[model samples]
Target chain A: MPAVVIGLADDPDQLSQDLQSPYPILPVGALFSASERQHLSDQYTPVEFAAACKPRFLNAVFARYPTVETLLYADPNVLFLHSTQPILDRLRNQTLLLTPYLLQAPGDTGPGKKAWPDEKHLQNIGLYNADFLAFTRSTETTQLLSWWQSRAETRAYIDFCKGLCTDQIWLMHAPVFFGGITIVHDPSWHVALWNLPQRQLHQRETTWQLADNGQPVLFVNMKGLFNPDEGFFPHQTRLNPAKRPDVMALLQAYRQQVAAKELAALTAIRPAYGMKPLLPVVRGWRRTATTALTALNKWVDTIYLPALPR
Target chain B: MTLAFTICSINYLAQARTLGDSLRRTNPDYQYVIGLVDKLSTANLPADLVPDYPMLEVDKIGIPDFQAMCDRYDITELNTAVKPFFIDYFYKNRPEATAVIYFDPDIIVFQPLTELNKALETNSLILTPHTCSPTPDWERPNELHHLNTGVFNLGFIGLRTDKIARAFVDWWKERLVYECRIDLCEGLFVDQHWVNFAPAYYQNVCIDKYLGYNVAYWNLHERQFSQRPDGTWLINETDELRFFHYSGYNPFRPDDISKYQTRYTFSQRSDVKPLFDLYCRELLANANEQYTKYPCVYIKPPTIKRYQRVRKAIKLPINRLISLLQHR
Candidate 1:
């Protein structure tokens, strides 16, 4: 399988040289109309913009490689620990394949239960992880991609209040809208922070398996591994690095690989698109003050101040 | 054998009767039962008001925490929350019932459920999306609303009495025990939102997109109803009008299409006027005026519930502070 990087770049040559990779870099700007690009850039954050570009990227890939039987989209942060042949094999009957965030329900007994991503969280974010998607060249796949593209173009923003979570939540309708969608329950596939509570990683000689079930770790999503500030995806407290030394070691190795790949310099090359002004990060005293004020406001609103009989 | 049922309090008995009457007329072979959330014994209804159909009270079913559920949930929430429990009751008791179908009390079947029966023959569970196509405008009950509520409408759920369907029901029952709420921020809307995971979680789950299956206010964007010379209704001049879910429709407010929808009025959707008119007459004939007077025995007074909610909200911040300090 050939790997392709879909990115928006001012100078493709500079980006290519910075990575020094064999994989071709497909420019995202050329795929859509100027108005569409403008709308996407205006509405979406850089992270959201990248996620929203998935369908268009896949559509472009299919158009480029017409004879390509199967195309799998994995986030740039993903590290493949095993072959993707099992996923591809599923595509023989299934048109579109999606990996759910958690194969097994989170445990209810332990202290981790409170911190673990519950069904509500899954419902909010999405049942299926948007990081990995497999598409076979079929009518159903075409319908899914087109439908996803339209939704991603407009509604791919991180708004949990309105039940929008950047291209992921929309896949909830994929099975209903487009038939032949197989929700791959294979525990090995697309192991990530959300599912880390249930899945225990262990080394078996050369291969890594989930210690509880002994399922091979096909691929691990390395999101937030490189960023110390984020610490394995923001707002996620389930993963305690003090425990799970196996996962820590794997993440450490992934970090070293990312470091070697000049992650700092490459990430510094700002995309020409989605130049929306970022929200200012609240830190230290400001964060504490904001939290306190919000709490106070809620408290005040909740305070029972009933009017006396007039 | 197929068993079709609807859950409703005594207040909605008129609607349930209308639904039962429609099913009897259309799909006569299928056994229709009214799953009453309100107690018939407590209401002490006259013989005239008692429905012709077999009525199963919620208490009859051995729900472990039945009283607790009634205390927590409102009328609508409690009615919807016990849906899976009814299904489970039938699954265990009704041995002859091969397929079990649930419809909201507010729905009326038009044609025979031939396609549905056929679908249920193979599929473990059959679900109908709230709308097959996109809503034309950002109207009330639009895509975002559907997303907030649920992708599939729980007004109609068809289940084949298989291991998978039983498992699905069991799983659904567990969730609806406490979590079957209309809380959008919590990503729940009664029993409906949880079924969004049905097709994904369970096997042989069919998302039946048949235009005729679940015609309602939300899906009126895609479906238009018209009666043929032969007296059978057709949706979009193609598929037979299998059923119409009169969700948010009130008989008293006859002119309004549905209170929940602002997308279309009777004037705009004259094509669907006859259907609503028919439903209104059917409901009235079934003693709608008398039934609406009966209050559900389960639901508590709103003032007490409101006070409790306010007290919880007041405690929330203080509780959070205490937990934070303890953790530190």
Candidate 2:
């Protein structure tokens, strides 16, 4: 499979610098018009703007490589411990391949089965791991992508009440909405801290297995397991080092790989588009004011109204 | 077999009776048990104080030196501390019991616990958080208050007789026996705060976020009240009103919904007026006046003046500092 690294570059020189990487690098600004970019920026938060751009990114990828039948979108944080050949083989027949949270089931001491993201977490966030998703280009997939883009473009913030979380929560109902959607339950796929309680890691030589006899871990989602500035070996506060020392190597390797990328210089670059969150003090003041007003309204209704004559 | 129980001292017997009546009307099939945290006395010259349901005194639940436990804890703390002991008693002794559901004495059941029963089929421990949805901007008992007090409302809990359930009961009992105080600063709010970790540690734990499950003043901002064509109360328009928890409510002051919750009143939330009115009638009919007259055998009844004096004494220095800060 041909590798492609896509991102929006504010500076043309920065895009050239990124092009030095082995993978074919493409600037997102080249794909969309300035007007389209402005519209997207007006519609979502910085975090959400990046998510809403995925459908268009995939469309661009498909247009560039017309022979490419399937497109896999993995978050920058995910590390490929194994090849994507197996996932691609399955995607040949299926329109969509999504990873199940594997939270709804009861505990069973079996190979390649772990329940990290417990049922409560799934209920809170969503069922699908939007970090790792595969979509085979089809009429149904095209329509699904359009529907997802439409939702994400408008309502892609982290608000659960509005049923929005970038693009993840929207995919929760994707199985019902789109046909030929297969939920990949294999534990080797999308292994992260949420399911660590169940998915035991045993590394033999360089290969990581779920249990004594499990499939090779396709990828390890080191989403929050590293802090380049702090130089912490394992950044997950939830995971105890004394207990699961097996993950020490896995996390250490991930940290080294991320550091090797030497993308620290780009960290200070502010987003050219989308909303920045309000200052802490400003947000706190707004909350307090809203609360006080509400209380005043209720107090008037309870105390002042009772004395009123009919 | 399934058993439903509530833990309370003599003061809450009237409320327990009302709860029993609700269960009798709504879910008569389930065995109702009252875990009395205080000893009973027949000194009161009035109608029968006890309800028709079986009463299990806290002492009989096999807590070693039960009197000492009672002495250490105040009325509220004592009532809450004895819950795990009673739950363990039912699960250990009664092998026939498939599940045990607990409700606060103040909660009045409207609809059968069908959703809870359905949840228990798969889950070992089920809990309902104070508010499943976000509460609109309010002064007190907001999301932060719930965070400080507890995530789950221990007033309504369902536990299936399983390994994790039994483990939770043991763990909770250990915590409650020592630290079931209502001291928010100390990170203790009876048994409620400890169970916030239930979903974290235990397996097959289900958080039943059903709108109707435990409707109270705290969650009223999100769950709207309405009535069905058949006259059955509904929550959020669609959800059947399973139970209404009169947590801080007093039947004596029917106009004031709850002393603790200043969020709503009879004049403000007129929809819940009929429900509170029905509750008041039931409580009064259950001889609330006479029942409250009797004191718990374990401890002397506190006088209103003394209680106020003690509270003021505790708050005097804090109040002085606040005034000083304002003046500065």
Candidate 3:
């Protein structure tokens, strides 16, 4: 099956390397050009940059490609380490694949339990993360577009310039609307930064990730970090970098694997991240390092605001 | 003692909890029963929010109020009852609690319900009728005409745990024994409105007066309300209102929750700016957090049929320009 990775071509360079994934990548763009696409409202809103780019990104992909069998999706920031066999295995018989929300609502009672918050976050975010999307090509995609089209007909503009509708709410019942969607959410597929620190790089799930999910890492979704802003790997969340020795060991014997220029290109992009000399940077962020000490002093006022007591 | 039973399913639980917490605070000793439709769990509500009260969890009665149905057009928990069945499990099993009082999680209490209890003096059953009629002829049970449930609004009811209330409950059981509907063609057989007959047969009191009780929408301006120098609201043609049951708009904020409690609701359009902002803040602070109201939406026609005549061209632009100039 030809797996299609559908995401907006916000960064074409990342889209090119992302094309070399285990499954083929299908880059989508919005109706507007990239320069004109970055629309923002004057008010400070809780909706993030990538989330605002949803309607255009969605319109681009569904309108462009008609034959999508499987979807291997990622955000522009997602970086690959090795061939993602485990993820594909889970999604083998699936029609759609999505990850769990990384940001947990306060007082989330874990899975199969109570989830209550006396107060909803005042942050007016469109609910769903439009990051990675996986779906088979069918009439199902049109159903979503029609539903969204009906909502957008109102032409009401609310917080975040979202036309008063939330992006996340649209997909909440996608399965019910578009039959046969397999929500494959292994943490290995989407290792987000909200749940990871430099120390927990070996294992981090998105949205308050835990440290010990024993499954082998398939693909690393390199999101939530923004620093050098060139290629995919040059983001700021790479405070401490780890060479995937585990992946290196697997590919060491495959001589033909060297031809996968995507891996080499990903490696070459690493130097631009400023964390080039990894061993020293790790020490710099670690305790007893003067960089760590000085950094804390500089950010204390900004970071240490009075918290709403738990 | 009277029993009040309010059921809030998981759908409106957020708004329900806010109302529940406030009611619990205002009437600490009142007989109250909270029935959760599905009995879901939550971290937001503290365990002590409703201390020493019995929580009845049961399957959704599967009834919808026509008004609440339209309310859903605007926008828009459980415990105890689990296992084999809820009624036999909660009512038959529990001995410590004598009566049940159910409050929709949306209601917030502004004052102690000493008045409702006092109203329960003679009758074994007490009910607050819809403060104002949905229409003029709503009271007559024409069947085709919408039933005036205020004649039997379950919003607040008192049931004598003894003969009368039990008999009413017994009657309700037999009626629900057949095609039980909380709301039907022009009547409801559940949601205490079914108990409207309890008063005719058993004995009940109907709370009727627009003295700021229940969902009363005063249309005319001068008739809406009167304010004194001391800031106490005096409903026109009336001396005092027990509690201004905020029914139309948001009851928590001043702009919505009328009766001169605070000017927050209408403050945005007021002459006094700083005071408006400060008063809104205070009202919001007093606004109970338990209820996160989900507003409903409705598809409204652009204009009424009488106004539809304006679509004939000449008066349309003239009216529009006049309205715009007036607005400006």
Candidate 4:
């Protein structure tokens, strides 16, 4: 198999020097028109624009490597801990492969004990995690790629109120709209913060396995684990170092591996696209102040004004 | 054997009766029952006002927190919340019933459900999306609304009595116990939004795109109705109309298409006018006026309910503050 990194680069030489990796870089502007790039950048934040570029990247890959029978795309944060033979075998004859966020229902353990990434969270973000998608060369796959590209170009923005979470939520319609969709139910694939409560990780002699049934762990999505701002997924508060020492150990190892690379140089090189339209995130004191003001407004209307006059 | 049922309070008995009459005329082989959310004993209905179908009161299903559910939800929410419980009841009590289908009380059957029954034979669950194509305009209930509400409409769900179907119902029942509400901010719109996971979670689930399956106000953009010389209805001149869901139509406002929609009017879309006219006449003949007078025994008065909700809203901020301070 071959590997390539698709990114936005203002100075390709500087990017190549920063990342001393073997994988060649494919600029995002090479795939889309100038007008299309402007529309996407103006409409969405950097995170959403990156997500919307998935279909375009895949289309470029298929066009470049016409003889390549199957293609697998994984997010940069995902780390492989085991062999990919099993996953490749599963995608041998399938047109598209999708992995759900959770294979089992996050049960109500008790009052203080609650499940993270419950049905409500999944309903908002999406049913399938868009971090990993595998497709084989087929007519159905081509059709899906075209449909997804059209939707991603226009409607790729993070608005949970409108049930839009970048390009993820739109995959909910793929199984219904397209043909030959296989939902991978193996718990070992694409393990992440959203499903940690159900998947317990344990290290074996050489590879990692699920603690309960000893299923081999293929790869783990280190999405929010490495982000200093997010600190292990903002939505997840149920899991901590005290609760699961094994998960913490895994994160520690992943952090060490990332530290070994030229992380500072890579982080310094900013992308050339999607610089405007900042993400709508209210952090630190701003969040606290916003909450305080909302509470104060409600308090005055309900308590103070009611007790006054006439 | 197959069991088809609809859940409604007494106030909607006329609509329920009309639905039952349609099923009886179209598909007589199926057993039709009225799952009453209202207590007939408390209402003491006259003989003429009562429906002729077998009436099964909701309280008889033995929902453990039935009283608590009534306290928490209003009429529309309460009626929809108990849908899965009714399916579970028939699954356990009716041993001979191999398939169970649910239609909202406002829907009328137009043709024999031959395709539906055939699909349910092999598939564990059958679901119909709100519309196969995109909505024409940004009307009241468009694609965004569908996303906030749900992708698949729960007005009609067909389940074959099997393990996967049982698991789906069990999960749905648990979620609807407390989280079933119309709060758009919390990503909930009653029981409809939750079934968006049916196809994703369960096996052998069929996302049936048959334009004939669920024809309603939300899907009118893709479907246009026409009557054949043989008195059968056809959609888009190709697919036969299986059922028409009169979701928001009222007998009093017979001229309007549906109170929930603003995209089309009866005059603008003359094709669907005859269907609405037929439904209005049937509802009136079934004592829609007399049935509308009776109130549901479980629902509290509007003023008291509003006051309770207001009190909760008022306390929400204070409760949050206290919790915040305690955590700090």
Q: Give TM per candidate.
A: 0.87, 0.60, 0.33, 0.86
DockQ of each: 0.27, 0.04, 0.01, 0.28
Interface RMSD of 4: 6.7
Candidate 1, residues A179-202, lDDT tens digits: the string is: 788888777888877777778899
Instruction: Give one digit per residue, the lDDT tens place, for model 4 in B10-78.
Output: 999999999999999999999999999998888999888878899999999989879999998888899
User: Which 10-residue window in model 4 chain B sums to the lowest lDDT?
Assistant: B302-311
Score each candidate by Cα lDDT: 0.81, 0.71, 0.39, 0.82
Residue by residue across A1-310, what tens digits does model 4's lDDT show?
A: 5555554423365566445556667777788787877877776667778878888888888888889888888888888888788888999878889998877777753235475545776777778888898899999898888878877767777677777777788888777666677898888998887677778889877688999999889999887666734321464655564578878888888998998886876788766666665534455665566567667755544442333254
Q: Is the docking of candidate 4 incorrect, acceptable, medium or high quality?
A: acceptable
- Across residues B1-328, which tens digit of lDDT does each residue of candidate 2 receive? 7899998777778899899999999988889999986666543434466578888887787997776777787787887888889999999888888999999999999988877787887899988878765445645675446544666788989999998899888877766666777755434577776675664455567777678888888888877788988999988688988999988888888788788776776787888889888889989998888778767776646423323444455556555544344333
TM-scores (chain A) of the candidates: 0.88, 0.77, 0.46, 0.86
Cα deviation in Å at residue B106, candidate 2? Answer: 0.6
Model 3 CA deviation exceeding 4 Å by range: A1-65, A80-96, A103-128, A146-185, A197-213, A225-310, B1-32, B35-328
For model 2, state the Cα shift of residue A281 in Å. 23
DockQ of candidate 3 is 0.01
Highest lDDT scorer = 4
Where does model 2 sit among the CAPRI classes? incorrect
